[model samples]
Target: MLLYCFTSARTGEVHESTARRASAREKTAKESDEDLEARVMAACYKVYKEDVPLFFFNIFTFFLPLASADYAFRDYSSAHKILDAAEAYNIDPLENNILEVIHFEDSIRDVPLFRPLSELQVTKSTGRSRGADVFRKEFASLGHRSGYTRNVTIRSCRRWALMQVDKNYSKTARMKFASYVSRDTHSKHYAHPLSEVEGLANYLGIESRNDHIQNRRGMGMHHNP
Candidate 1:
């Protein structure tokens, strides 16, 4: 994604290796904080004007982890807001739901920028506890936004999956596929079985080898590999 950003910023004329080397060279020259900030803001503004949907999706993905955590904690209000926004735009939110490909350019003709982040409160205390408290509050707000995006994605995926099975499968097959997709999305994406289900298993004294195996896989471990 970083490479994509870099290439886009440069208009894709430069080769990847050339771009990397150029970036490395530029890094050697110490940049003042103000200069760096100016460059970053300029690049962001350019992207915002040139490709608004990419900007929106980038922001959505940035908060996605926090959104997933919020959903896992049982919050649904944020997710509802995101779904409402997508519905208003008639967006499906699938991975391949590009505006050009899906012919949604007309739908988002007047789309607005995302809401600004909440202002951070000024704190007088320099103590660790005060810092931690502020950090926790800021993180909670971010998590709320993130949960919204995750829910939107999950709902979109669910709808798309259902449509896919309906068009291509027999009645019985459609039913089976719908049931499996729902359970999979609920367990893997929203509920997160490793955290929620494993804890439940521990409480019920039903923890098993399968749970351990899943935990390992979730951590990016693979027995075959």
Candidate 2:
């Protein structure tokens, strides 16, 4: 209506007197609808379920009280429903993206659904500090991380940590490696393996060939996340 008024005025098709009357009536018509307007205001509540955030919805709906008295009815019930739904189901979406240290805790508690800590093959380190021993003591009786001797060609443990954190392997590759290592480590799946350990070593410039190196490396070998 504003545009029509402007266009009409510019073209001189409507007299100023006529434009004034039309604008007044248009403004009155806009303000006159109470029920239809209120329903429209109520309908805005649907934004809660859409991409909009709950806080935004709350602020927008707060002005519902400022609407014409008839249009001021608030939808607190709908708002509460939306807030409840978000709280109930809103897992930190980023949790799925990153492997967190806490995930190991969950994996431990859930058992069988996720890989146990013992499944990740870690090379034995030197010394009797027992870092590897501690890592193994609390889990399934699988892979051995013992003191290394001259004959054992143990890989770097850091590489294993890197693979745990950053590497992405094909499902087929993972299953095949898991099967092969499990046979040696005595498990069905291998969580930490040669590639992972190798990757970590390369990144950290730590050569963990035996428990001597691993002992020096200590808990630093496992990826933090």
Candidate 3:
């Protein structure tokens, strides 16, 4: 017997090109009920989950489902039954579930803009520690949001990660963020798009608001990436 090997350039893995086909053929000859069933289930998922016409099943599932079908195409009703049984899940429910646990504060103050670093009294304010903890927790939680779903989280994580620990280190963002914290004349200050997540008092879900001075009209998420 000649063994055929094919190397896939994308993944850089050597594949035993004939192994599956040969095993499937051997299985066809012996016809073990359990092995055939597993193959049948796999084929069923591929066909149902993907939008493909029945005639095109051969091209899609590597002809594996067709082989496992055991006259599945011939028996049209049985094929329909298999296809209809495939499972799919909606992520809206997952997002809703996440929203349920998240809390938001409507009256939260943004950091003061351009406040001299000398003015901050982190030791006197309990809110400062609490807010920082929320940002940190938001960064630590969740499997990543695909795009901008966690835009707030993304910005918070970025700022927190990029910040220098040394007190005197002057990053452009630090004072602007301080201004945001003070919530003083936030109307006059311009914030980076990523820092926009800090507007909420404390929250995970998104909120819609209109600030005529800075954004005039806009929507933003309330938390970290």
Task: Give the clash count for model 2.
Answer: 14
For model 1, the stretches where C-alpha displacement exceeds 4 angstroms are: 1-34, 37-45, 49-137, 140-212, 217-225
Writing each residue's lDDT as its tens digit, candidate 1 over 1-225 gives 232231222211111112233343466467554333212221111123323343254434543333332231122335455445457877556764554311222222222111113311112211111122233344445545655322122233344445445446675675564444343443343333333235556777984435574455344222221
Residues 87-206, candidate 3, lDDT per residue (tens digit)? Answer: 232233332232111111222222221112342342232222122223234444542443345434333333332232112334445445332334332224333333323455336556
Better of 1 and 2 by TM-score: 1
Residue pairs with backbone atoms closer than 3 Å in model 1 (clashes): 67-146, 67-147
| Per-residue C-alpha lDDT of model 2 across residues 1-225, encoded as one tens digit per residue | 121211111111111122133334454665543412211221121222322332433433442232212122133334344345556765754423422111112112211111123432212211112122232233222222333222111123323432333346554554454323232331223243233244666778997455454454444334222
Worst 10 residues of 1 by lDDT: 119-128
Each candidate's TM vs. the true structure? 0.20, 0.15, 0.14
- Scored against the true structure, residue 174 in model 1 reaches a CA lDDT of 56
Shift of residue 173 alpha carbon in model 3, Å: 28
Q: What's the best-to-worst order under TM-score?
A: 1, 2, 3
* TM value for model 3: 0.14
lDDT of model 3, residue 102:
13
